[model samples]
Target: MEASITFGDDALAARAAEAARELAAAGVPEALAAGDPTLWGPAAESQAADRLGWLDLPTTSRSLLPRLAELAERAREQEVEHVVLAGMGGSSLAAEVICASADVPLTVLDTTDPAQVRRVLADRPERTLVVLASKSGTTVETDAHRRLYERAFRDAGIDPATRILVVTDPGSPLEQTGIESGYTVVQADPRVGGRYSALSAFGLVPSALAGADVARLLDEAAEVRPLLALPEGNPGLELGAALGAAALAGRDKLVLDASLSATTGLPDWIEQLVAESTGKQGRGILPVAGGEPTGVPDEIVAGIATDGAVRADGPLGAQFLVWEYATAIAGRMLGVDPFDQPNVAEAKDGTARILAEAGEGPLPTGAPVLVDGPVEAYGDLPADVKDLSGALTWLLSAIPERGYLAVTAFLDREAAFEVPVPPDASFEVLTDIWAAHDAATLQGLLAVRTDRPVTFGWGPRYLHSTGQYHKGGPQDGVFLQITGDVPDDLPVPGRPYTLGRLQLAQALGDLDALRGRGRPAVRLHLTDREAGVRHLLAAAREV
Candidate 1:
């Protein structure tokens, strides 16, 4: 049950100690252990307090492990070979990490990318079990995925009931639908929030289905639980204190350097948890997960070490608890409600509003001037380099001292190219095609040219992951959004808009949200996905 998490330096250690004292004075640990809502600030007495059950999950998991194991056994008995988890953010990230280390095959479908959806449906549909997970039972992305997969299953002559499973809170619409549709439904603890449900059914169910040792995972978490109950030298509290103190002192970038052998997607999970929980009210801690350390004065490095020889299940469980507790404590230190995502709703509501007015007018457009085939110009500059160099110059110039550039691409990775390949092509080939259009080369060029850290995030997906940090975290991000026309758009079964339209709306919504926050941002629309990517690379070389 031993875990390793060290402070970056003596200054950080001293700041952590001071933060721990401040939290102790605020009675954060005691209030959390006692299930007192006061630790969440003035709104604790509302429904927010009722969702604090995750605070005690490590201690309560002993009762849930047996059921999770039984469910796993049942899936095996039914010959379920692949489990496709359809969820977003907290509901799927933990399962993804577990699947990375587990024996059972699992594919997490968190993106609404038409190509990704088609890939999942084409992979052993008859033998695959789709687990629709959502705390609220109404996450738009989750529901959309459910509809698409259900149609895919029906089209493939597979009974949706036999291939689908439901994981949600009791009495949720999804739960009722599962019952009416004759699908297996497993209700998660109603008291746990999505982000905090990593130790609850939302996480454990998928881990169990993936053949991970859920019992041992809970045992590891239990070990960390005791440490969290104490104020002094408590790993969770100390880590939280360090993060909070550093952020308040203007070192807001939490640069996490996780062991390559650690559980996959671990950094992504932490990014969402920290950013969504503490980034709000114009003050926030920005977690730079799995990115190259910028070494700027505003960065704090957090190293997550794992024994390279062992499976990461146990270590991952402990790490999950550590971050959950630390984030709760950090919220107290930052004086923000840790449970609510005020700005997250802004994008969601905006999307819904756009969807409601689907037929009213053309979807909101932040049109970039088309400079050439699939290449567009975003900012005013010399005509010779308007397509790529001009855009790069504008984006690079937007970066403040010590700030980073986030390249958010809304392009579908699988469909961004014009060249055709065989139907039986391997994923590696697809990846190679994607790489040709990806921002890796561009990121390197920016890093070398500007001497600033660069982060690449896929749109809609990043909206669910690091989008919080972009809007809610420190105002030090310069956003460059890349989007293009889909070769063929897929329509939502019953909705007026297509997935392509939804993607566009989301990208635009997020862009508007960032601009509303006054974070420097610009959008580039690629008319020819392949040619535009090459143009961008050419522009990077010039820079």
Candidate 2:
């Protein structure tokens, strides 16, 4: 059956079709290496594009639908009220999509946040089901979350083995964990990478349990495969190729949007996918996550220098119109050959190594106050990072020649209540404490570019605005995630739910939601109470 197309605008479809053809041709190797040698490269480009064609290998993701339906039935039979998907990257992205788009309330935990662990245990009812998803059966985040859940189950007098669900490749570490622990186990496709596993049971079953119309999603995905295979007027392939070319050309980042619950794992997933598939040499698309209404980058000022000078030279001077046009003009500029990014594989290997070293089959680091700073932004800050003061000076000193900069702050409930915000419908749920910082930051960003409007919101609150505006909105925004490490971790009173564990669990949930949106996200973990106010002040400064 042909997937139904809505939005009821044929004119728009026609316009997109015209642009898509040009883009596919540009990204396609044969078309690029025409009579004009300068138009494209030699043999490499053709091979690269040919390799990328595997994106369409699964002509139809038919199996996921029925599996999802069956999982949904199982959930109903068990009367599961909530599901916590414990995995990092691809294992979790598909689950995120389902949870976000589905009618039910679901949460994703991708971090070892003590606060989050406490919250989940406190909130988890007797009917809660924990799905441990790790394709290779070894991801630190997934293993950690699974252990936390298992511990909770044992503490609550519930059989740990009976309370958990396992999804991974056959004979994988996670599968072994399930078998040894006596949990129900399901296998993922061995041929699929974590990034591509979204179309497999890896993504679908969790989404089905979360209440998404998995059957419709399967139908939607199936329709795209053939279109992508054609390479002309195919949005998926065109987008992937275009994005790949853009990364090769100079644009290094591609921010994506997704709902809070379902799409939380997308950032890690996309990061792995694009980084592994296309990050050849020193080039690759750095995918980050953002939420709806809030995650959208309010402004993209390309030429702002550290010295406060705006130079319109070289590609820096190019306008958004040019970027838009180039998307179709250049297509997959890397040619038709594969661009193997070994670092991508290495990173995964490292994670596996750490997990395997643990004696407990699927054990991971327990929840903590914080994870290390961003791998990319490690030394970017100051030696003494007690508060926001050092962070501000760092931003001013190392301002990009022409790149995006944002401030992320974590405010307490009281502080959040004092913040102001826009009149948009999405901000209604945001408490005053959270709005105070968002409003102040938005104002500061706007001051630099009054012509461009700003978008902002609070976490756990703006999640509701995800559906129509995020994945559906215009894709030209940057994101900054500001959060605070709560001094006192909240825990479930009197139970096995420890405060530190709970905090970590909730933090992971918050982070996964933002990551799932697929945008450029920087986490600013405030150290103390004063750090929140200081962070707001730092955001207001012009570097």
Candidate 3:
């Protein structure tokens, strides 16, 4: 199951050629293959050597095949009906790609939304094995998820220890927690970062539990490893160089065209890898996956081809290795640290600050208003389409040339748009009206108005995916954050904050981070989620 890579235009091809020459001169290919720290440039001394272990995951995974198979067999013997992975970013996305093709039922819960959390908890706790995966072992969302589920299991008269698994670095707090709670603990390599750990234990454990062919995946990856050793003919190096060159040439948008049948959720997984790995220090690659192509001048398209029409033998593993290697090379070319997430901490810090300031009182609120610039409204605005239309127009008008608009929604996922609305009132309403609006109208409207790309990301989820690029990459994004009050909020077990509050804090924190970086941003809070969505859609129609 070999894969092919090609550029969408000649400009990208020429850039790849230039990048290949520069990478060769700098010995990037050899340095990467040898796991040399020099690949990190001036920061080589500060970077961790183990972070480079992902480069040899193919060879290393071969050694763990037996153990992975044993885990799969154990799960089958225990009759675990569902495997739920509680993780974020690198820890969970690759597992998702693998589980999509697996025979076992697997659900990756990465969102902090209370509704999403409840949905996962509603699953048969007795028959489900929850895998707590975090590379750092201190991820807030993962920890919170573990706490909530642990209580849920206890409430259901089931001991969580018997049905829980922990996958993390050796001696991490999570490993200790799992051991203390009498849960099975799987130690991942301490050197591998979350996004790059798809070939490591962090990925394989869940993949195996989901009944995937872990051995064959590693074998396919091993076959592609040799090609990555060369600077010129290496697919990884060539792709990386092309992306770096494209970014340098002001075509920073790396649009991915993946076969849904061949690579389920692979594009989303790549979105986080490329965005987080290369986006930093005011330079980054914005990965647009499965979105309407804006056909903008500053866009480069990359296609992923797999073996079969519906199922492939080894495309997932091959893709994991290719993108991981390419992202490392791209980081070098962009002159940024691929492994370190400097800006990601800012949002986390902001969330902490907000949590500290939060008291027993109700959450803070602001008045709704319409202004000339990016509209900052609270609760519900006037139903008159004119006022909302004016505000939306102003926001759209502010989009600069070559700039893009990111619509981030922080509404409750469970009941986002469950209102008494007529089916034929405007357009047919889907379960997620916000997504429908963004897909059917919002993106096209904004694209036509600004002549730029339009991207829509749901709250906190995008924080792990594109948040890195938003704050650390070029400050050319116009951010519109949509947040609303949840009808019924669920509290985190033994914590002062509820999941609703936590979700809002995350949304506000990231918004503050963006604004702190001087990025153009606006917030629209809705007391009524359905009405606000309708108003937004009506405004889009006016445009």
lDDT of each: 0.75, 0.45, 0.76
* Candidate 2 lDDT over residue span 1-543, tens digit each: 232112122332344345456655555423332212233346444434432322332443464556666767877897888887777666775567456545557777654445545566666657888888887676655665776677688878888776688889888988887998898887776655555556666776676777766565555554444443345433343344445433443544444332322223333344345434443443334333341122223211111111101111111111111222222232334442223223333323433344346433422323332233321121223456433434434444343432333333223323444345566736455654464444344435432542222334333222211111222222333344455555666433333443334333333343343345453444554445444444444544533
Clashes of 2: 59
Predicted model with the maximum lDDT: 3
Clashes of each: 2, 59, 0
lDDT tens readout by residue for model 3, 1-543: 674456546767787888888888878788788888867766754664758888888987787788777777777787888899998888888888887856446888887877768878988877788899998899888988999989998999988887788999998899899999999888887778888899898888888888788887788788888888786667788778877888888888876666644657787888889988887888888887656556677776666662211111237777788888888888887889888877888888888788777676655444556532233464233344246566566667666777778877875444444445566665545534545533234555665666666777766777877888888888888888887667778888777888889888888788778878676676776666555665676666777
Per-residue lDDT of candidate 1, residues 1-543 (tens digit) = 475446548787788788788778877777776778776657655756777898678777668777777777777787988888998888988877776755456788877666657677788887788899988898888888888888988998989998888899998998988899999888888988888888888888877887777777677777777767677757787778878888888787776666654566677788888888887776787766546665678777776663211112238778888888788878877888888777787778778777677675788674555465557655334345555676687778878986778888877555444456668879999777666666555666676677565777776767776777677766778988887767767767866777778887887778778888677777878777667787777777877
TM-score of 3: 0.89
* TM-scores of all predicted structures: 0.90, 0.60, 0.89
Q: Which prediction has more favorable lDDT, 1 or 3?
A: 3
Candidate 2 matches the true fold with a TM-score of 0.60
